[model samples]
Target chain A: MGREIKLALVYRDMWQSSGKYLPRVDQLVRVAEPIVEMGCFARVETNGGGFEQINLLFGENPNVSVRKWTQAFNDAGIQTQMLERGLNALRMSPVPADVRKMMFKLKKIQGTDISRSFDGLNNPVNLANSFKFAKEGGMIAQGALSITYSPVRSIIMSIWRINILN
Target chain B: MAGIGRPVSIGKMVKGIRERHPDIIIQYHGHSTPGFSVASSLEAARNGADIIDVGMEPLSWGTGHADLLTIHEMLRDAGFSVPDINTKAYMHVRSLTQEFVDDFLGYYINPKNRYMNSLLIGPGLPGGMMGSLMADLENNVKSVNKWLVKRDKEPITQEQLLLQLFDEVKHAWPKLGYPPLVTPFSQYVKNVSLMNAIQLIKGKERWSMIDENTWGMILGRSGQLPGELGEEIMNLAKAQEREFFTGTPQDLYPNQLDEFRQKMKDKGWDVGQDEEELFEYAMHPQQYEDYKSGKAKERFLEDLEKRKAAQQGLTSVAMPQTSNSESNVMPQSMTIDVNGEKFKVQVAYGDAVEEAKAEASKEEPKPTSSGELEEITAPLEGKFYLTKDSSEIGIKVGDKISEGDTIAYIESMKVINAVAADKSGEVVEIVARHGDDIEEDDVILLLK
Candidate 1:
């Protein structure tokens, strides 16, 4: 068949990461066809992270936007995914289990096909709920470990140094 | 990881994950901020990453992720079965993005964020937080410089302020237990660092302006940190009587969906075709309220129009007016305030302008203080100090001083403002102590 899909263009986050606002739903609709025609991204990230918050800030109902926009991508035979904060679940603080489950259920109904969940601390416990709930809502559960770099430290050397200091 | 990792590290991590769980698919989400995106993407893919996240042009690189075209092409070149990106559609999307930027979003974007910063390697803040970080830097620099200008001090540059803030972030990250520099945690680290930098710049000590949210992170309410809290922070927490948290962070926030549902019903808000609206409301209560009340829209529209007007003003040139009179020229000096910052502009015309400029440059001899007792008063209400530290006392009783000499300093909101003498005189009486709280027009000394 055609080349296997291995890329998910995070369109919403691009707008947020580059500037301060997301594209309006109409703008998203206009670009969705072209993005699908490109045949590059297997999935497109329509919303996640700051999506709902930003939509609220713009005085738009994010649910409406998500439904309309993700529908466009799903109709085109492309999978639609959202970024989910593990434990936080689209928020800065820990979200309740029932509310978090409802988020996945509602998002799946709103045409979202996948939930790429990540925990800031890379804590597995925080992400366990997301895996369970996303699958329960008939969405593909993708777990991501937040990555960062640190100079490799020798723990044994450190312990020896600590003992010497003590 | 908030910051990007080296390609080798990413490859190792991906390979380890792939080996441990062959059925699991790995996706590496890395930012292009540190200029290591292309290499890392390739490494991740080679090491068994099933998907790689990327962004489109006009929104790629800088604080955003690497572009899809580059990653696709690179992966294919490296012999991966990646799908071909339709060049025509890519161009169309690119053009559409540019159009969006030109329409209004360009005014909000900081141009500095368009390029990669190697310095981001130190702080490792993810691309998501970089937008606000740059914006905060711009606002804080303007504020600090304005305060400095009022005290007749030289203005600090954005680079200088950013560098100090970066250093502070590096310092604060480990001190606060090396929480992964991501959302909520990253923001907390950044806010604390920013506050510390501003305070340090104002001659105040670090951790002097830690807010409650930062305290939350420090107290371990968010979660377990990767490292121990610094002794200084622990001591401060002890002094504040804030207890440490060792329980599950998520359990602290119990199930509150029913509460939110009841509240939404009271407000007559729809729960959407699904319950997505309720979820949004529950997640962000204040923002949702503002959105429903139309306050957010009003504020956003006002800000957009203000930015648009400013752009138009900057672009429109002043056309010279044609006059019938030939000698329509004169020497003038005036002060103009731009966005609340004052600037003095001098305009001079005629052949003798050079000579006049030279003549004006010469300083006129000043009459010494009207030969009377002069009181050196605090220019603002703040803590007054006679010296920067104990090692040096700037002025004592019976010390001679000239006009414009910094007789004392007044610190307000952590910013130290030098109080200068209005006229030349000998210090006759010292009235304020080194650490006394003083007010505007409060005399620090009597000079004669």
Candidate 2:
């Protein structure tokens, strides 16, 4: 409980941020207490405007498995359907037709990985939005954001100087 | 002697039951009657009934029982608890034909559509008004919570506070005599006013005091729903219309109201007008009242028993073997003065509508307050069905049937939900259009 190693996590708003609408975020947030109390920190790495890919920077537990996090969120209906394109990376399924249609009209800037439901309260974005951002085909821009997810400790610690792409 | 014997006119079987068991607790079961009739459950309290029952039909579990508002009032008035468990499985069966109400009412009238009756007929736990309100609010919140779960959206400020406010208002309304039917419609309207405020929050639409709740729905009907409720109806209806009243949700709910509406709307015709009226009709006072607390129903039973004994003695002494003819009986019986004028009509009590009708035509007599009078009414809608022979030993032309049988039933929603004799007695005169709505409460048929 002391000054836990701090990690800065980032994600986009799936619904409405300031004055625009995006897509409905159906994926929920699951918590693995091993590292962070909430769960692994998932962020969308965008290329230019449209989404490119999503990276799950681990929390306190650097070796916390991807299968474990995805399965955990899936059971809670946070991360519905996902296509695992990598060990630390994942591209989620597209939004449902009904939801996508509504969000399409409602979204002002056509966003990627922005959680609009209550799940976003825990983190900045929900699991569903993260998957959707990658599902729409966003790529991992130059260097990957570095972070260490600790499942047991339940605290996500950021790592620097190790940009994989760079 | 008062004209009393009539089918569907059981003056307090509740009283009958309570007298048999003084310490017994009365229980209300699930019913199809609309909200106002459910409020009539207040009679249970007046007569000393106990415990009321209900289920979550549609809008939301534990929140959408058609009679929820009135049921809550009945609970408040009697100071009893509302039911918590559904004990019986219930689904809101809706219609979607061009005539919305026609389909809805038609389905309700059908015995087959009723899937939520006669379960858990035995004794169960008792509850109070707070529990009822709590169950309603908690269950509704749960449903809303489920819908709001995945949104990653910001929590609308003060949702908990707003819900608390709504619960308080709902609790207090019953003290005002169960809200007079039109009130919930009005209250919903007011709440929707706040619903518009949800728009001010992030991720919600911006609504004004003026865009008419979101367009493409009826509003501001003079007598139908209060104008105050117009906005709320607009607000909620806009959403529900998309979900249930007009949309195609068959893939999700095949036998639901949404599916029905989808089927009917496919015709590209409009029958929404009558559908609304049918909604009103379903809310009529039901066959029985909710059992109240204490012992009013007990005392009421004592009074009814005494009244029955006194009337019984008088009848036996005067006209023991009364003929089934209009002219064979006395003509001086005074019935209750409904509203203003003394409605002098003979009384006939019977289980069968036909037997009562026959006795009404035969031995029934004119009600002159001399224990000999009856109210007259049409037998059916088609052609006035009457006895061909004038010399029949039953009721004469001038006699009336104050209570024993059904006067007539104009068939509409398939079968006969007849307008039976309020009181069976003699026939006086019938006043009604060949094709007109049955005006029973007004006594459009003035029996002499």
lDDT of 1 by residue, B117-231 (tens): 8887777766567787776666566556544544555667777887888898888888888777777677777877887887777777888656455676677666667788899
State the lDDT at B20 in candidate 1.
Answer: 57
Local distance difference test, candidate 1: 0.73
Q: Identify the candidate with maximal lDDT.
A: 1
Model 1 chain A scores worst on lDDT over the 10 consecutive residues at: A157-166
Error of 1 at B12 (Å): 0.9
Every model: Cα RMSD to truth: 13.2, 31.8
- Model 2 docking tier (incorrect/acceptable/medium/high): incorrect
Candidate 2 local distance difference test against the native: 0.27
Q: Could you tell me how far off, in angstroms, the CA of residue B279 lies in candidate 1 after the best superposition? A: 1.7
lDDT by residue for model 2 (B1-448), tens: 0001111121143344456556654432222211222432444344545543232222111111223334544455555644332222111111111132232222212111222221111110011111122322322333233223323332222236244434433432232112111111222322333333333332445233222211211232111111123244346557645332233111221222333244345635332342321111111101001111213234334544664675565454334344534433634443545456655555433112333234334532333333344344332222121221122233344655666344554421111223456565445555543324331122324543
The interface root-mean-square deviation of each model, in the order shown, is 5.4, 31.7
Q: Summing lDDT over every window of 10 consecutive residues in candidate 2 chain B, give the lowest-scoring window.
A: B283-292
